[model samples]
Target chain A: MQIAKVRGTVVSTHKTRSLTGTKLLLLQFMDAQGQPLPKYEVAGDLVGAGVNEWVLVSRGSAARIDDGMEHRPLDALVVGIIDTVTVENNRLYSKKDAERG
Target chain B: MQIAKVRGTVVSTHKTRSLTGTKLLLLQFMDAQGQPLPKYEVAGDLVGAGVNEWVLVSRGSAARIDDGMEHRPLDALVVGIIDTVTVENNRLYSKKDAERG
Candidate 1:
């Protein structure tokens, strides 16, 4: 799993029929210090994550687990919402901090 | 599918038993112009692709199709090797070029 920040939403009505009800969000992968990487991808929203929220993204085949996406040709998926992230016992990011300002 | 170039190989002898016989190769994603993206991943090799070969990577659940990975937790499988890539009549990459130099 990689840490990512939800950047935007994707509203696609002309996609394949199997992808009809899936929620797609634009994501920016973040480093441990909460900085965005240059790579960005569109991922399925499985946890109701809103824009600007920090999330854990599961890539590749792991992203297609049991979501009616078995045949939908989806790749990246938002799997969890991160409340806090710490590295080497050092505070890096916290949802409370994002909520405050 | 995305274009990726195999950079190296991974020799993991202590991994899960399900992955015992699977070949894992390190890959770097490539941009349309044949430059490498800043991303690298280890993917299962099904087509016997050697190092430095430009391959077409099918990501997400699509990566786990067949090859007896249904019961195993594996992601990022190499599905195909690219013969050539042409965009707007421009030859972006070719196996012949990679074989030349």
Candidate 2:
């Protein structure tokens, strides 16, 4: 899994039939320093995360582990919303602080 | 899935029991133009890919879909040895050409 930020929603009406109801969100993966990377990915939002929120993304076929997602062609999924991230005893990111800013 | 080049073998004598017989290969993913990206990943070798060979890598839980790999904690697997990659009708890479060089 990787940490990412929900950048925006991606509304696609004409997609694979099995993906009709899945909410796709545009996400930018974060580096170890809590900064966003250059590339972007579209992932199924399994946890109802909103835009600008930090999230945990499960990649590849693991995205299908959740109930009712087994047959979808989803390769990326937003599995959990992140509240904070600590590395080397340092608080790299805090959701509350980001919200306040 | 992504196209990657096998950089070398990773010998780990003491690893998770389920991975005892699995061969680990260090790989570097390639960009669209066939240039290798900066990062490297270690993947279980499902196919017999050699160092310097380009291969197709199946990532995440998909790596576990092969027979007898269901219990392993492997997140990446070399699924296929590449012969060539043609993009826009141009041959970007060919195993034979690479071997000759």
Pick the DockQ winner.
1
lDDT of 2 by residue, B1-99 (tens): 899887665443333345568776667789989997865556789889987899998877788899987766566789999999999999999999999
lDDT of 1 by residue, A1-101 (tens): 89988766544333334455877666778987788787666677878998789999887767667647676546778889999999899879989999999
Span of ten consecutive residues with least summed lDDT in model 1 chain B: B83-92
Count clashing pairs, candidate 2.
Answer: 0
User: Which candidate ranks first by lDDT, i.e. highest?
Assistant: 2
* lDDT, residue B54, candidate 2: 94
> Which residues of candidate 2, in runs, are more than 4 Å off?
B1-59, B62-101
lDDT of 2 by residue, A1-101 (tens): 45678999889888889998999999998765567789788989767888998876667776776667788998887666666655334566777888999
